[model samples]
Target: MRNFLTAIFSKDKSPFVNAKAATSWCKRLQEIDMQSQHLKIHAAVTAFVSEERPTTLDSLSALLLIDDAAQPSYEAVCYQYIANPRMSKEIESRLWKQITSFAVDMAGVYQLFVQSETESGKKAEFALLMPKVLARSLHYLSIQAKWHYFRFEKVPSKLWTLSHQLYRLSEIEGCDSNPFPLYTSHAQEVTSCADEYIQMLMLGSLSNNNLSVRQIDWVDQWLNQWSKLIQMSRKFQEGRYHLCVNLQAPEGVQKIQAESEGEPFRYWGLHDLMHELEETLRRLENGATPRDLGMGKECPAPLAVELLKHLDIFWLMSIRNSVVQRSERKKVAKIADIISGLDSIIGHVRFDNDKNVRKASADGRGQVDYDEIMDMRLYGFVSTRTKEKPPPNKVVENKQKDWHVWNIENESVGGYGAVVHLSENEWVRPGLLVANRLGRQENWHLGVIRRLNRLGDDEVYVGIQSLALSPIAVSLYMEKEERKEQISLAEDSTLGVADLPNIRTALYLPHQIEGKNVNTLILHSADYGTDKIYRVQARERVFMVRLGSVIEKGVDWVWVTVFVISQE
Candidate 1:
């Protein structure tokens, strides 16, 4: 029964999913309460798997598309869903339980398969079952690693016990099918990623927090298991790369064969796996700690910074594959891309830099930005991003987000200027996040404020560079509604409009602002309780901005949603 359940969820189409009716039945089973109906479904799955199943290629047509909502919905409900996930609470503990159950179940099943190998009668029967059991077990381990490491939602226990058990079973000469070093390597990689993530969070959140025994154990185990996996899995590639693709598929290699018909998908290739592992580790290096995104407040709040800090991972993926539909993910990807293109500073012009820009332009790749040269006075400030450790080359000192006020002396399309008063200890460096003055939200539309020139002893002129814009809108408040302030982008002000939700209409775009196009929100105010979606027709692509963490009652402009919405 246990093995059959694995088969049903596994990448391959087993007899458990033989026909349209069977697939429909599987979908129905997902909707039913997993706790109440698991036993019956287990029995049905068991019965189907015991029979001789079809191996026809035609069955491939039944697999779900990448975007099919039902597929993720089913997976979410049965294997990894929460009834109601509060940002304040850790995602459904059932996912943790299910993960634990699979690890335990697979260990027992491996033992049973090995013991049953003795009886020739059983060996013939177990052949088909063993391959899938090995495959599905590996498949879910990747998922576990993703949620635990990539999402930083939960901490994961080491997979050493289960991998070791399978390793011993594989050593048995005729154990039907052999499990490869895939388990061993993955066990180490997944565990290491999780440990590093925890350690990083503790460090980032470490103003007054002490390292607990649990954190120590996590770090210690990661150190212990990483060595063991290297020894057990054998040093095939050595230090060249953590993962690689196979030119011709080898029998000993662990691969998800079904998803590709004749090929594998899940952490199968060396290149993809290496990229996956590196990407996860990089998140720990540069992103919000588990403490930042986790449900528990005991962990510590994320280093106060832009959403961009938590979004470094998205920048690693190709642009097309980059964006996810979720509001936060979409917002992060868009902002990350937006900031990436803003790497232009008047200082530090490598000769080859213009060559690269010209090549990129000839490729017809980026947006054609026209430079507007202007001079003006504006108020701005500089704040450093929170770091996990003191920067190596940087002078040893405070790493917190230190706010220092500046006087903006000039402006341009690419960047703006300001005279900064830095203490003797401080230096105006390149690639720092500058809070370009946008009303009360000082850090709104952040740009890199860098050293342009020296005016005198205490004043250092700095430039803020980016292709950024902000629109002024009246903020409406609704308790429990996610976006506290919705920017109504209409030409006519909310004068005597019948639906007068908020009487105060004193909203103004920053003085001296130009080149921002606006549109009208259909309803003057968002509906009584729920959030309202406004259809805006922008002459050009206009964005509705949301600043990360400012929810207060005021007339001053603040972004309710940081990610942009296309006016078109």
Candidate 2:
């Protein structure tokens, strides 16, 4: 009946699972055999072997033997069979009786460890499972080959034994599969199943807070291998693609199983494995342990930084064979932006001097550049461009008419016919012509702030280089919510408006009053033939301003000006 029950419950639960179910099923059978304690005990023994139940010396002492003398018999049966070289079906069955009794006697051990605060109890619990683990392992290996010294019988010891082995491997070996079939599908799968079962058992045991020696041994052996098995399984499956694609597909179950076993440890490659192993060993020897960090909290900023590190690995493995989704791509792009912003904040440090930027504009990758930022304390006026009206709607005005407009030139008879102003409407359709400013052409003679000071209650004194009208606007990026603060800076005063023209650049001049700090200088312009100069200051402030004109053939010159202000 026990054999029949074992066969029914011990089948593969899934492709990725192994047969560790027999252990739990046998325990359930014990409850059903209430009338026959011997039967219950026999069932326990069978369950123990199949489930790799621990067979420690202390565990056998607590079994409810028919008589006190039978207790010694139980111990003798367990230790002798486990340590004995001889084997027979009858002898194995008798051995199963003692082993199961021992497991049942040791039940609730995990609960004791979980609940008890005493270190001695915990250590004792850990130590108790060693013998059972050794015996079970031997039984499992023997049954795995479907033989017991050239004889075969209904031995379910293989299942629990596999779980125990898997748990141990995971704990010791980083649990990654190591190009061995047993490590991946066979052994690892059993380990996974056993882990689930063991966790359930441990939970139950913890509630009791008192487990017999056998149970303690069982829990320890099972826990030891559980994590490693999981790691091994994942690594093996992940790297399987590389093996299959690069080498060849595994032919049969045995071969596939064998390959899965050792593939994970090998997946890291020899050099990486060596380094990782060395590091791990160093930690172990030094008694230093890795911190147990929670997943989300432990992750780095700019998720892309983490992803980028594994891009090469994913590409080469071709493991998943799936394209990244558009949403995922967008997320990655956002992460990339965050990463770049962080890099900028930290101030970029380059390993080698960039020579490309020095060579040509097209080659700007490697270059060392610096910009000095100063807080020029100034309080100047701010203004906006006047909005233009719709074109004249009268049809009579559109008709062709004899028109003679005078070419008027108001020239300063002596001090150079320099500064000129056109009506805003006329400036709208402005043309580019070579006009002289100082010693340079109007297009090339970019403006710069010499000084800006409050002239009167409604006007601000300003000095600029360009001989044309200066047009300017504040060009600082402020927090989205800080617009109120920015507007309040005008203090309800009628701020001065400037028609600063060709104002490609503006600098906040340092105040002669030594202690006053100059704050802001704004520049305004339409797209000129100039390159935009993006600037980042020490105070995490950033601004983009047009510097001068570009002499390219297809590029059009744009009109721009500058405005100045200060927070003093």
Candidate 3:
């Protein structure tokens, strides 16, 4: 058996025998259109790298060539999955595992090369390899961090420890400040080991901050420029700087504490970076072009300002201290059987109409069964168009199979941290609007999902921010002059004013404060227009209102303030 195994192993040859060979192989792999084929090729390369254990200068050159060539495909797959909320769980898991394994294997190979040169007492080779080692190791670590951040999950402690150890290793070799050309297709930008280290630290600090996938991507893009402006050193710097990292701790960068003591710690100040960001923001606000100010070409001025403000808060204070305190509790809550959207929220909240109430009373029940309500609402609410005026676009059918039963793991003034079986709610994602009924309560409160993290294959945790305690269902009609003209030209002059067309379903949320006259409505994204007037019909009351600025918006809904023009 030993002889046979040796023969089989000896027959296995490395595709990366030389730099040119590695490049050719990578080009062939890139030419393959199927992602599944790429996965197969990646697996084979990974196995060879891990098991063959090539330990020569020629092998190092080939490995670097392969790394540069393979990165684009791996990152493309990673972002493709991250941006898609409705991706299959099985495919996501399989692809993510392969990508992460590739990163780990690549980083390990580079680290091994550094170790081999150091132990062999080859000073010249070691000096030449140190900067590449630091840059590649940090780049791979950043990939791991990006994986977690995009998934809205916390990075593992072991990963943080490994990152800190790499930065510490660079310090020991006196090459922490050595510059190397980081691979990019656009320009040959030079970066140091310290810059990469700080980028990792900044990424770690953003965990649990409830940033959406797009916002996280924006931060990652801006960090490429912002990280260059940051300064790190062993000595404490003057000014209002609070960022520090302890090399001995199994954590990333954190707020500096006056009383805490730790050796071999690095203090990084963001004062200079903050100044640059503020200056750029000022120019943007004053009508400066984003590309001219070094921002991304596609990024708008408002988005640039929003991202800058978000970063400013983190640089000025500790995220842990800034977060709201959540009360730890284990209580089960009954979630409604409705997919998140303006239509679903309105349907669920308005289920107890006069007709349903009368039917329940006649049957000797206080209210109808929630499950029956869901069934009726889902299948029986298709809208029909009239010959004169067609109804607005029909609401999409709800796809939920059953009610979500979530366990309230924690609670705070703003929201609840809940967990449910992943199989029960595969569509749950950030920015999803949900309706929850707690403990047999008749009234259902509305909330939006702000964060989501999978515990494993079976369960998922989500953070939901409460929006409204008791949202009232209302119908809205665009208050166009043409609408008034149509009403006047009706065949039957007795046609009521409420019988107009283009009625859109919306939710009316009352003011939170008792003496405030503020009114807000959650409407479908298509129904909202700047400065458009709307006639609101709420059960027995009718009023004319005008749309105000949008407070928040999602894929399917928009929350906007409204002013009551007149009540009848």
Candidate 4:
């Protein structure tokens, strides 16, 4: 009598009455845009999966159709947030909550199907559903992991524990190696539960704390193709294999030990993955185009090589131990001023006539009657009469407003770990180049944001890596005929004033003395060209130099090694 009541209740609790109803719902969802569809689908799916009774096959059919329809919306949401990490907190929070809830709901629905099939004593149905269940569960779990990493937040332990448990369940069911369609968009592309698990492990092994959001996205995309090369095993191998994960550890992949002490662990031998990466690097170094090497056209060979090399070192080498010792100290540091972009940094460091430009009155008109257009232009405001855009390397005006105050929680030789309560308009992320000075200090130092963690709605913790101690601003001119003509005019002038063309503003890092042969120059990204020679004007000295390989690059600046051609 109890079983009969349970059956009746379960049948009534199913989300869809029949398969036709589910099909019609999916068809209707297709008519709407992806952004709107996600909200509706999420709401309905959440309600359906929240039922108390066991999920039925009819509901499973609806769930599968819903999952298929939700893929595009899911991808759209992930791309939106990952591509624009600095979006408004309200929108970001909403998207994060929705996407996270959707992933959890989908994973739970699939887990229910697995449980229901197993308990029904239908071996054939269980066998058919096992691979799909594991694949979908891991897929959604990977999405959750990526969103967490993009925000630089710690992924919950339950996520990893459940991921491991799912893969283990697949292995026990003898379907871990079976192939299934992972996505509706790419129905022909089949993958196994093992491959999905390997991809998760690879993602976990990345040094996400050090990589930019875009870099993390690239690694995630590339792993879709690269994870197939990795092989997993139950037995521990020697030097060729090192990475492993304990199924019961509730953590990510780590270095394997010779003996596991009878714990359930899976080992992944990265020999093949490393070999492929090394070969790709060699091909790239041999002048093979990125497109020819199967990388997209937008991917430069150098960038591809850099990413591959990073992955190679991360996978093959043992875990790195930090050598720099940090000290905890409580102190207030006025971020005296913060500046990003080569133009902004140069503007702050250099003396320019723009600072002397006349100010605008209450009506937004220049006070000075003479040279009104020139004054407005110098003030870095768009003029209706001129309609001229600022030069690419022009210095920005009125930078004092970019300052922030922080509490330095720790100090080290390399950088500082500071926390700040940021205003709505202010934003910071990893890979941002910043110039900071201590409170009441006149000297400014250059650094890059290496890590960032949100402590709360308005509070953020940042790890900065100092680049130089006393960088001086300088003018760099292309060594072309126009520049040579300007130099001749200066030499021939009685007043020693030459009307030179607008040259690039670059930061000369005096502390980055790379021996007597090489120096470092931080120049605007647009101003950097391969093998370009430049005449650099310092305070009292002038020299000609040729740019070498790029040491590092950001959205607006490039740190390139320079070789001295001559000194005047």
Candidate 5:
């Protein structure tokens, strides 16, 4: 009450008083009562003494100018706490929440501006509002996006300037905040949906081998949901940041209008979304793990399909432009053909370097060579669209040999080599191995040894194991196994397939993935391929282990453990 009186006597109403002047007052108060922390409380109570609430008439006359320059002081306070441990822990905690609150509110303002201008058809207002709203929007998004990227991916940089700018554009174009919570909640939704779609794609990719009809339906559903969610997210961003304000106006307030001025904002909004979606797809394919960005391990297939779809659209658009420009039809046709061919090739070709080769001396006394052959198979047509029912399981013939001698020159014998040619369609399963000879060459023995040793040059060994031990549960495990060693786990019979270690990894599932109450797990191992003793099963929900990864010579194997599903 005494402090309240002090505020009533004081002159300023601004939240922040000069710290130097306040410090002396604080010191004096501390001497009065160490337990008393009423400075701010008193300040709040007396804040209204000198400040009068705006009257209804006055409010009507005043412009609601969102002061973008008036950055919330909460951010500075939080930064202070983050940079200094000497500050009171209580102060830090309070500041963190305040900062987050300020950020959300600030973003809301920009969103409001973007939405208002776009809907109003005030092109001039939108043009004028664009730089300011976008600037602030980018600022806020960069901060949040960086936090996520850092927490999840451990990316050092906190700012993706380009992405921030694009996000601003997206927001102005149109993004909704109704469905998900503002911060991580919204982020999680986008990532989780993306992940689900990816999973569907993966299942579809694997379906040609042995997946069931029900499994295919699940994939299709995922794809549909994934496309819709992405579309929604894209719409939100585009709608929020795209404002083309006019320069000439009576009140100097420009309004936003469509490029053509005939159509509504939705077209432009969708266009912006498409641009961002394509960019995101490109990033995922290139394996660029941006900071705080959580893209779930959904199959790459859907992404590929989406990208191809856009590519086709872009191609048609480009062709239209070319025709208008009177550009050479033949050149345009060739470009389109190339794009179509690339789309088909990427759709069907999946390359994996998972096999290793080992050879010994003529007398099997010393290590002669060890190589790993990365596998790549070509399919006639592989759709990115999810299928409702998985194709019937079939044993696709793998018409390739375990080892092919390209060139062999023995220490004591003549050089002789021949290429192994594929004569039939190969049924390549999840764990199948297949190899073809490059061609015949002189010094066949030496060439074979060299090729085998070369596998060591580009080998990344990941181990997978699953076993049925009981009727209830199947255990699973995954671990990074870098060195070669003889590792073993008992196969439980009663539990059915207990676990499948590194199975998700084998299927290229993302780390820290969860689905339908199924927990993915990981284990360490020292083996790979047909040589590794393990089984694969799907039915009763089982524990999946995705290991905490540590980088090794890119060629290390992972260990995993799994046990049967158990009601007990």
Candidate 6:
């Protein structure tokens, strides 16, 4: 009442003063005694303020701008309360809710701008009237088609830098908000393909709010692209790298001495091969004198050929007597061929080094699974798009997730082996960011897809390396009964995050990686203090992880260690 009287009677009631008064009133509402009464009173007050203003697109845009303008003052006041422990926390929670709520609402507005079929063919002529809608629509469209690369993927799933593009386009072309310089041109350039039909729809978006989409065809196009990639990636989903191999090449063929361009080796000697075979057998027999295969005496070429012919017939007969499951040798080869072509985009083929050389000493059937392997049912959610340098602890928060229920095949210290269905595994890939949660628990562990394996026609077993567990829930104050009753309760929480200060580092991987992959990544200064992002170049699987990050004094230097996790 005293504050209200001051607002009415005092000389100063300027825009800033009125805004300050409104903010103070809102802040005071937090101090109301009863939780129920507190929420109810504030709700009534807010509803009253909103009552006079109808929330059209324009009104919402105005409110958003106003909220943004007032944010700094709220933050300043929040900072002022830093020394007061309780009030500091209370102020922070209020600020977070305001900011988060605004963001959530703004996201809805942007989505509406792109998706509103009713608003098709509407020319956004007046910038002052519809700046938010126009700006966001143009921004999102540019992001979908990166300056150089055009993603055939879903719009919301893409990432890009469009602030400069939007500003320039808005100022220069005066088409929509920021005219997409190459969006329409790219469509015209792809006239050779039958997919020109799809490109036409893209052109519609580039021109105006006229998105003339054929729903069935659009879905088919999206699914077809995803399906082909998934089919190519299936072999990789299973423990594809652990395939059994014959260590020594089939013997007895007449040596074909050959040399190719830049070949490291040429003309491997027959005597050297025989000696190598004898030595390997001696080691296998545990230093017992190996049964000599007459390697000491060279057999005539005719006799060697005859022996090899008989051996080939025997091997063919053994394969004919093999198990009922058909070999996927041809399909595996097809997958590898396709993957090899796209090695520049998706990561290179990473082979597992689980050389079960110990199996030669065993019964040769294969190692058995132990009972201790935890069989927990869980869901793994994969992020749709790739990130070069993701923000810290925000892979999951950065949306558009496709999730699948997977059976945890086994558990390890820092990782887990899980099986996902064909529909699910299609989206999963090595080095891709993923979130794993056991059952329905909200708790999630952020990680990378370390490996993928295919079992048969349906299932894909994947290896996951956990980086960090999701932040702890702050709702511990609520009892189980209370939680059940008030599941949709308006909760207040504070993030104890420090200010972001710039720092620098160098990219020097501590682990041993293949020579080809080692030099592929060059950690740019722009990526310093960014999230642990996964980026692969050719065969190079790259990401940055911090070992001892601290805000150092004097130089403001923060040392974040980088790592390249791969198998040789």
For residues 1-568, write the lDDT of model 3, one tens digit per residue.
9999999989635656767777677777765764654575567567766586666666677777776766667667876766775779898787678768777777777777777766776557557766777778888888788777766566888888888888888888888888777665433667788888887788767755556566776677777778888777777654544578888778776656663344767777666877887788778879998788766675677887766665654454342332334445445454443336677668766753322322334466654333233223323432221112222233343334345667777776677888777677767656567887664434668888766556764667788878876677888766565467576758566775545565688988754434554678989877889888887876544678889987666556778888877865
Which model, 1 or 6, shows the larger lDDT?
A: 1
Question: Tens digits of per-residue lDDT for model 5 on 505-537?
Answer: 232121221332122222222333322333322
Stretches of candidate 2 above 4 Å error? 1-40, 43-223, 226-253, 257-568
Candidate closest to the true structure, highest lDDT: 4
Stretches off by above 4 angstroms in model 3 are 1-102, 112-129, 143-156, 167-181, 184-339, 353-403, 409-413, 439-441, 481-499, 511-517, 529-531
**475 in model 1: Cα distance from truth in Å?**
36
User: What CA RMSD would you report for each candidate?
Assistant: 22.1, 30.6, 11.8, 13.0, 24.9, 30.8
Model 1, residue 536: what's the lDDT?
A: 22
Residues 312-423, model 6: lDDT tens digits: 2222222222211222211111000111111111111111001211123245574211111100100123222222322222122223233455667676656677665656
Could you give candidate 4's per-residue lDDT for residues 1-568 as a string of tens digits? Answer: 9999999887643335446677787788878898888888887776776655446565666677767777888889877877676889899898888878888888887877777766777556556656877888998898788778766676789999999988988888888888768877869777889888888888877633356677787787777778889777787655555677889987887655445524587776766776787788789889998789666565677888777766655453332211123345445444445566566777665533233224354697643221233223233454443334321233255436555556667666777777766563145655567877674335567887765566755667777778876566778877575667677778775645446656678887633333443467899877898889998875434678898888666656778987777766
**By summed lDDT, which 10 consecutive residues of candidate 1 come out lowest?**
370-379
Poorest lDDT segment (10 consecutive residues) of candidate 3: 382-391
- Those runs of model 1 whose alpha carbons end farther than 4 Å from true positions after fitting are 1-35, 39-84, 87-91, 98-103, 118-125, 140-158, 164-568
Please provide, for model 1 over 12-33, each residue's C-alpha lDDT reduced to its tens digit, 9 standing for 90 to 100: 5442344564556556655666
Which model is ahead, 1 or 2, in terms of TM-score? 1
Candidate lDDT values, in order: 0.32, 0.28, 0.68, 0.69, 0.29, 0.31
By TM-score, highest first, what's the ranking?
Answer: 4, 3, 1, 5, 6, 2
lDDT of 1: 0.32
Clashing pairs in 6: 237-452, 237-453, 238-452, 238-453, 238-454, 239-453
Worst 10 residues of 2 by lDDT: 330-339
User: Best candidate, TM-score-wise?
Assistant: 4
Better of 5 and 6 by lDDT: 6
